[model samples]
Target: MSQLTHRVGVALWGIPLLVIVVLIGGGLFALFLAVVCCLAANEFYRLSESSGAAVSIGIVCAGLLPLVMHFRPDWSLYFLALGILVIALTLPSHRLENLLGRFSSAAGGIVYPSLLLSFLVLIRDGAWEKHYYGGMVLIYILTAIWICDTAAYFGGRAFGKRKLAPVVSPNKTWEGAIFGIIGALFWAVIAGQVLKPVLTVPQCVIGALIVGTVGQLGDLAESALKRSAGVKDTGNILGPHGGVLDRFDSLAAVAPVFFFYFKALGMV
Candidate 1:
């Protein structure tokens, strides 16, 4: 019944599934992400609807656009551009009112989880020479985000005073943010030590700071969406954890940042 209990119970079931999917990094991993994209797109459409926007079913199909990256990464841009154009052009005919609002929300739903999450597939498949090492990189990022989230949750509960963003996410506090960054720093150092050949100490520390900051911001962004929609959680798919979007919001933010960081460093 407690939040902590719900968190732990969900982790028990979810973590293993995640490990299995990440380990099997081919069609299986792509399929897993595709499924998540569908669920998240549905949640986003539902959220947009709550605001009186009429999202089209084609927008939901657009969620599958990112899976193209798994096979043809270069085509992703065209897919996104064309998909958005189609969604926009179709909107005027489908609904007579609030065309702009509906189009923007529909386009956003397609891009957010679908486009952002494709980076995970890219990371797992193209980031490194060895498949195993690529998996490790993905796992490292996931672990760092988990550390940050867990620390923030408890830290806020225990020592929170100043609210971070009272209007966006009333429960978050500056104290929690500080603790979360600290947790990320700690893990980054350990990870850097273990992956010394691939990552330097400085890189780890800096990456952690960037990831921690962006991950929290990503969480806040989702909170803003939920607040706008006037909902408590995205969906009931994850039980106490909310939904796929709720669980992966931080990941959605962290993945692109982390991937680009490695790419910029010529590591990827």
Candidate 2:
């Protein structure tokens, strides 16, 4: 009935299913991520359309190309190059500005929703290779991000004074952002204690900092995109929460950061 009600209802069903998919960690998870990225890419294209830069709908298939890189992450460059070439070829326009606009939008769609989200698959698959706690790592990341966001929202509502990014997201405040970071650290400490097989307390704290800061920036980046496009919410697919891109913006931003962190530590 209410927006909060819708949010909770979706999470109630969605979280469990997400846990299952991440834990499964293979083709099933890859297929699931492919669908989400495609939908998010479609919404991003719609946003670009609203900004007067229309990309070819056919290029939405470019979302699937990233999952192809799940097994061979090095192929990302090739896939991106091919996507750019295809976009340049497919989107024919008379004005040079129009062509550039379309090309930029198409390329952005490939990177944001497609290439960025693919790291989630890589995170799960790579981590799963070494330990059973791999899925738990993903779950920890998601949970920390969610907690950070939730704390930010509520904390902002209660004690928000200074604007964090008034131009992009007017409601967000520095107070809320600090609260978000604290929430993330809180969860990381708890997870570190339990996920001893994969992470140390120090690693978890570092992860909290990365996910907290990067993930919030991702949210702001998405908000900036929506603002520039002159719209609220990328799409209404997620009811009160907006769309797939709206929901997963933070995760998309954090996935690569965490993935690389694990890689650097020789964990994934």
For residue 198, model 1's alpha carbon misses the true position, in angstroms, by 2.9
User: Any runs in candidate 2 off by more than 4 Å, and if so which?
Assistant: 50-59, 72-74, 93-97, 127-131
User: How close is each model in CA RMSD to the real structure?
Assistant: 2.2, 2.3
Candidate 2 C-alpha error for residue 128, in Å: 4.7
lDDT of 1 by residue, 131-156 (tens): 77767777778888999998998999
After TM-score superposition, what is the CA distance of residue 268 in candidate 1 from its true location, in Å? Answer: 2.7
Residue 49 Cα positional deviation in candidate 2, in Å, after optimal superposition:
0.6
* Candidate 2 residue lDDT tens string, 107-137: 7887887777888777777744464477889
